[model samples]
Target: MTADDHALALALADAAGAAIRPFFRGAWSEERKADRSFVTEADRAAEAAMRALIEAHRPADGIIGEEYGTRNEGAGRQWVLDPIDGTTSFIAGRAIFGTLIALVQDGWPVLGVIDQPIAQERWVGRIGEGTTFNGRPAATRPLKDLSDAVLGTTTPHQFAGDDVDAFMGVARAVAESKIIYGGDCYNYGLVASGHIDCVIEAGLKLHDFAALVPVVEGAGGMMSDWMGNPLDAGSDGRVIALGDPARLDDILDAMS
Candidate 1:
């Protein structure tokens, strides 16, 4: 992606953040979806705002969003968006929720942005360019051993059937005291910022994981599914992120 593409990604994130900020901590109506996920007017408004901006600025680019479905499916350039990634947290009035924006060219992610409107913090990343927190460079902290690594997940309940057993096997391999929970997308950002060492979770959708690839990789981390495959639109929902590339095989082994 070009420098302008990176800027456009950030602008889309900013627009979504602006649309959602007004509803934060304020009274808003919400309803549960068939998948048991929550959605609110804030989510719709933010996504609509982003879609309008993209339509106006990049008319040819396709769009995929959480609140709304896909559009212009075969366009070579597509933007993936999750206007309010952690709606459960957002409704609970927690600032850990954020907006996710990614630009996928030819089915490969090339740029990403994770923006926390309440905290006023954003991470922008692109292929070949290191990630930046706010405006300064950001990179992960390297840890070679699982015993010393800090681990995180949004919720253990997300795992079901065989996934629970597989996830626990990997969890037990790490220090029990170091396993933290409930950060949603914030945990991934923390991994990129070097504040966390690893994040593993299951049952994520394309919109949930697509925007995260470039941000984590750009910050010198490795992100993939449990089978050690690189994540893409067609990847399985299971995911593992290692801040230190050297730990990839070990973590994958533990999951296996």
Candidate 2:
């Protein structure tokens, strides 16, 4: 990615944050999506703002947004967005929900930004470069063993069938009372900042996770599918983000 691309990614996050701040903890329209997930006026507005800026700055690039469908299909570069990743947290007046933005090129994510407007915390990541949290360098904390690691995920309800069993296996391996719920995209940011060791989840869409890979990997961590494959557009929704890569095999063993 070029310097201008990075600038544009930050600008997109800024626009999305501005559009979402007015609705946080305030009155706004809300409804359930076909998937039974919640959607709000703020989500739509934030994505619209980002799309407008993308169109103005790089009309050739494509877009895949949660609120709005895809545009400029088949383009080599695409912007994937989730205006508010944790709608439940947002509806509950929490600041942990975040706006996720990603730039995917040739089916691989090259840049990502996770913006929590309410908290005014932002994490930016680019391939081949270090990650930054609010302009400061960000890095994950090292852990020597799974028993000492802290784990996080948005909710156990997101898992079902075998996915639930797999998640429980990982939870059981971690220290007692070390698992946290209800951070959504914010949890990955915490992983990047060394405040959380890992996050595991399933049924995530491209918009839900496209931005997380770069941020976590750039901060000396690793993100992959449940079976330890690199995440790309074609991978299944199962995800694992680890602050300490050495623990991957242990986590995978636990999952199995």
Candidate 3:
């Protein structure tokens, strides 16, 4: 991947972010989904706007999005987008939410960009091109064990008590642990940058992962499901990612 791919990925995410900005402070009625997740007027509008932008810019490429779903899935090059990753937080007046856009070539993420409009921070990365938060390069810290790591996850509060207990077993063994609630795609950026050691989640879709995969991989980390499989569209609901592979196994083992 080169500067051009990174540029295009960033531009796409930025366009999507702009589309979601208007609904930030505006009043929007909420609606519940089958899974109990909330969706607002902004979610649908942003996703539609993002799909149009991707179709216009990457004419031949396929597109996948959270709200709009996918049009073409078998294309060699596809653009996956999540217009507002943390919709609940977005509607709750929190700025921790952002847009996730990624370019996947031949089933692998080639470029990724997470645009946090509220924080005025944009993370751009390309496979083998390294990763950057804003304009500065970012890389994870060298903590080799979960025992000394400060782990961050999307949400542990909502998990089943038994599942929470299972995870907390791993957490209690760690030096520190915290939930970056409503972090969405931002937590992956955090793990890649070394501010957080890990970002575990139980439920996710393709649009949920597209943008973060490369950013984490570019920063010399690994992104995979809890069962030690690659994160494809059909990935298990659980995900485990770490900069240090050895420590990752430790975390996974503790969970098991």
Candidate 4:
């Protein structure tokens, strides 16, 4: 990605944030999709704002967004966006929700940004570069063992079938009271910032996880599938983000 690409990604986040701030904590129309997930006016508005910017600034590039569908599907570089990653939290007036933006080149994420509009916190990451939180460098904290790790996930309900059992196994491996629930993408941002040791989640979509990989990995962390494979556009949605790469085997073993 070029410097201009990075700037455009940040601009997308800013546009989305501006579109969302007015509806936060204020009354807005909301509906449940076929998957039973909620979508609010704020979500559509934010995504519309971002889509407009992308179409104007980089009309040749593709876009895959949560609220709006894909455009320019055959383009080599695609912008992936989730206007409101934690819509439930946004509806509850929580600031933990974020706008996720990612630049995927040839199906691999090369740039990412997680923007918490309410708190004005932004984490930006690019391939082969350090992550930055609010314009300063960010790094993940060291962790020697799972026993010493603080683990997080959006919710246990996100898992189904054997995935539930797999997640429970990892949860059991960590110390009591060290597991946290319900932060969605914010939890991954925390992992990137070194505030959390790891986050394991399942059933995520491309838009849900594409932005997280760069942010976490660029901050000295690592992101992969449960089987320890690298993530890509075609990943099956079971994800593991570790603040310390040394714990990958232990985490994979615990999950298995």
- Ranking 1 against 4 by TM-score, winner: 4
C-alpha lDDT score of every prediction, in listed order:
0.89, 0.94, 0.76, 0.95
- Residue pairs with backbone atoms closer than 3 Å in model 3 (clashes): none
How close is every model to the real structure, measured as TM-score?
A: 0.98, 0.99, 0.89, 0.99
Residues 60-142, candidate 1: write the lDDT tens digits.
88999988889899999999999998999999999999899989888778888889999998988787889999999999998
Worst 10 residues of 4 by lDDT: 247-256
TM-score of 2: 0.99
Across residues 44-71, which tens digit of lDDT does each residue of candidate 2 receive? 9999999999999999999999999999
lDDT by residue (224-251, candidate 3, tens digit) is: 8877777765665577768766576787
Where model 4 places Cα greater than 4 Å from the true spot, the runs are none
How does residue 245 of candidate 3 score in lDDT?
61
RMSD of candidate 1 to true structure, Å: 0.9
Q: C-alpha displacement of 3 in model 2, angstroms?
A: 0.6
- Determine which window of 10 residues in candidate 1 has minimal summed lDDT: 1-10
lDDT score at residue 95, model 3, on the 0-100 scale:
83
Residue-level lDDT for 199 in candidate 2: 97
